[model samples]
Target: MREFDYQRLVIGYHGCDASVRDKVIQKGDQLQASPKRYDWLGHGIYFWEHGPARALEWAKEQKKRGKLKTPAVLGAVLHLGSCFDLLDAEYTDMLAQAYPLFVDSTKAAKKTLPNNRPLDASDKDQLLRDLDCAVVNWTIEEFEKDGTAHFHSVRGVFQEGLKVFPKSGIHRRSHIQIAVRDPACILGYFQPPSKR
Candidate 1:
């Protein structure tokens, strides 16, 4: 079990339209937004941890897809506030326990578990992470119901793309992600310093 300094605050960066960023800044907080059914990390405001360039890349891609007229990166200072960190063994153990419960719940409901798959044969940047998302959400739900703990956010490091070396866990596109379930964890939002 590796030790983590959960006490330390971290910065998070989000990619979105310039208009959206402006609205959030003007409002002094992020507007309430529903989580997408296909959200990669199960229903929260998503940010790329320490990956401003990745955020910008996503923004540009959104612009190219006509989803955003003016792409921008929004930065935030985050206090994790009871984080469910996947990188840690404690959380992973909780998840491991939750998986069986999740499976049983889905089976009882007569629904198949959502399975993850590649977004496309050639697309390495995105994966269909529905299954992982579902399990995490289920775990949170169970915890809330039992009054054991309330997680304000979930954090994880995902290793994407080709590995940096043979038998290495590190990847060319690895990045940390933070999903803030509670808006209060976001201390404040700012425009990327470079953008200003």
Candidate 2:
């Protein structure tokens, strides 16, 4: 009867095409979950936690990649129920422990674990997180097999972009992100307020 519920609510932003945003906000359409194999947080609906600016920036980048025509941001009220928060040391250690298990499973299946690769030589952050994705997905499967901790959401902190200043560890694009595995956790969707 124990649930690892965080009992916290937060505003999350999703970046997409302008049409997609209108459908979800005005027509009440469901936002599709991203299932990319190299997704940073495995397969789920991704969001920028309390970060509308970051979310719009991402949409713009997606447009450059031909993923969308016109960038847009959608706001949502999220309940971080039963979240596997990587910002905490506990979940991070658990993920490290899950690595070998993930390796073993892939080996058993006669497959190789993919590595996180950079987009280009200049891409130091290694945006393609195949290895991280596999381990996270495997860990969730372990929980499912155990039938104890079926997490409804996952939260992670990602440091990205160029340094704001020389000799500074702070990155211009550092932000906290979330992946909602359960659609029910999304209380409602709204139009993001314009920048003040």
Candidate 3:
């Protein structure tokens, strides 16, 4: 991979319950990391890059579903140390190499490889992506075993839905996502300025 200046900081936004936002502000620390097996970008604290509106939308949706009492957006400044950036061909090539090993391991364990299923039969807006998540996490684990590389975070751009215009691969829901594997990378957090 090309040399990346890990000292540079980037802005990210996260959606959550208002109460959760308040706790982070009061504690002066990042929210707890998520280590779910099916985490899309592997186990980490996820954030939408420069996507405060998107974060708010997600929070509002959660509130509508009764999962959250109040919607809010938290902005963060991240120091991406040794980031595994999928946008770069070098990292992607590395991941490609790791896939075969993952497949072999799963086969040896007599387990079916997870598949990316639609969130709902009628909703194409989202995909489950369990397999993708598994492979990525597995790749990281394998790399760590080698003791040659350690990634503090993973960053990728996802394109969802059809293009807004003809012939354009860009999708309506295209957005950048960052999964911070190391909590120390998050320098600080703040509530975003209210759109209202």
Best candidate, TM-score-wise?
Answer: 2
lDDT of each: 0.83, 0.90, 0.85
Selected candidate, larger lDDT, 2 vs 3: 2
Q: Per-residue lDDT tens digits of candidate 3, residues 35-63?
A: 77666788889999999988888789789
Clash tally, candidates in order: 0, 0, 0
Worst 10 residues of 1 by lDDT: 1-10
Ordered by lDDT, highest first, the candidates read 2, 3, 1
lDDT of 2 by residue, 129-193 (tens): 99888889889979988996888899999989999999899999999999998888898999987
> Model 1, range 83-181, lDDT digits (tens) per residue?
999889999999998899899999999998887777678867567788888999999989999999888889988888888999997887788988988
Candidate 2: clashing residue pairs, number: 0
Output the number of the lDDT-best candidate: 2
Consecutive 10-residue window with the lowest summed lDDT within model 3: 1-10
RMSD of 3: 3.1
For model 1, the superposed segments whose C-alpha errors exceed 4 Å read: 1-6, 27-29, 124-126, 163-169
